[model samples]
Target chain A: DQQVKQNSPSLSVQEGRISILNCDYTNSMFDYFLWYKKYPAEGPTFLISISSIKDKNEDGRFTVFLNKSAKHLSLHIVPSQPGDSAVYFCAYRGSTLGRLYFGRGTQLTVWP
Target chain B: EAGVVQSPRYKIIEKKQPVAFWCNPISGHNTLYWYRQNLGQGPELLIRYENEEAVDDSQLPKDRFSAERLKGVDSTLKIQPAELGDSAVYLCASRLTGVADTQYFGPGTRLTVL
Candidate 1:
């Protein structure tokens, strides 16, 4: 049973364009959500996150939107750069506290 | 500060062999977790420890998988008589004890069973 899902396996966009990655979850108990970026042969690094209480959170060029009613969230990278090319995983922290449920991940490629 | 550290970046072994992966969490971190990630899939939590105590291990396959955190700072995961289906990446992550604290992940150990 996959609690979190990222239907899109890959995405392509031109540099300086907008890149959006979507994620959905089944469990409503999840209160906090985060996005992690991973490179080849490296561990995932924290990108951005949004709490269920808020609808949107923004950090510079990266923004995360949370729709609690739909159990969905999305990461938006404005003016995407070639350096942004990597696998992005969306994770959720439920009421369980320390554990995180991760999605399959989406590979985003930005072409210059 | 340094991130989580894991050894044996890659390992290849035949079926029925025993293998082990080790992880060292970040300094001052109290929560450590072990995960298994299959190809084209997300990482699945195998076990989680708070200090020296395992808080959650429901997903662990106890029959063949075993784990330990002796000093509450480092951890080890072992697979006995590994099967071909055991080919996957083993990841270890750590975080400070709190709500919504970010988890720092290790480079991961890739295991291939022939």
Candidate 2:
């Protein structure tokens, strides 16, 4: 069973625009959500995270919004740049084991 | 400081062959993790180690997959008589003992079983 799901497989946006990636989860117990960016042939790197207690968290151009009622979260990048093109994964930390449950990732393309 | 290091970035072998992958975590990081990522899917945890002890390995396929983190620094994962379905990218990650959410990952080893 896939606990986390990213319905969109890919997204395309022009530079200087906004990019939004969405994720949904089936479990309500997940309290922490994180986003990771991955380049080709490289490992996923941490981007932004949000706690269940907060509805939104922002780091620079990246922002994550969580909605407990909808069991959904989203990562938004304003004024997206070409360098922001990569695969983005949405994950949640397991409450008991601290392990991560990840979505099937969304490939974002920021074209110049 | 160096990040997590994994050797033999790529490997290809027959279904019945045995293969091993190695990992060296960042200095002073006592936690280590192994994950397998299939095509078009996110990574799934195989095991987690604290120091030299494996604290979580419920996802590991113990019948053919085995792992060891000796001396609490470097680690190795071995698969014997591999199956064709085992082809995937294996990733290693590490974090400081007290860190809760952040994990640094290595480049990973891509394995192909023919």
Candidate 3:
């Protein structure tokens, strides 16, 4: 069973628009959530993260919102640029051994 | 500083053949992880090591897979009698001992078993 899920397989947005990617999880015990951006043939790189204690965390043009009651989270990138086109994955930090549980990932395309 | 390094970026072999992938984590990082990602799917953890000790490996398929981390710096994952279902990209990641979320990853080795 997948503990984390990215329901949307892909998302497309115009440059300078906002791009929102959603993710859901079945486990409530998780406290930390992270987003990673991956380019083709490259490893996933860390984006932004939110702790359960807070509902939102923002880093530059990227913002992540968490709704614990709904067991859902979303990543928003404002003024999305062409460089933002890539696959994005949502992961939760495991409380036990600190391993990461990742979602299937969503491919984001920022068009000019 | 160099990031994680993995060798044999791509490998192709017939079923029942043996294959090995190597990983060298970033300098000073004590935690290493090996994960396998199937096509169109997220990466799944196969094993985790804290230094030379494998702290967790419950997800690894021991019947055909084995891994070793000697001297707490580099690791090797080996698969014997590989099956067609073993086709996937194997990724290696590492982080500092106290860091909980940030992990540097290598380009990964793409393995194809025919």
DockQ-based ranking: 1, 2, 3
| Model 3 chain A: ten consecutive residues of lowest lDDT | A93-102
Classified by CAPRI criteria, candidate 2 counts as: high
Each prediction's TM-score versus the true structure: 0.97, 0.98, 0.98
Which residue ranges in model 2 land beyond 4 Å of their true spot? none
Interface DockQ per candidate: 0.86, 0.86, 0.80
Where model 3 places Cα greater than 4 Å from the true spot, the runs are: none
Worst 10 residues of 2 chain A by lDDT: A93-102
Q: How close is candidate 1 to the true structure, as a TM-score?
A: 0.97
Error of 1 at B16 (Å): 0.5
User: Tens-digit lDDT track for model 2 on A2-96?
Assistant: 99999999999999999999999998988899999999888889899899999999999999999999999999999899999999999999964
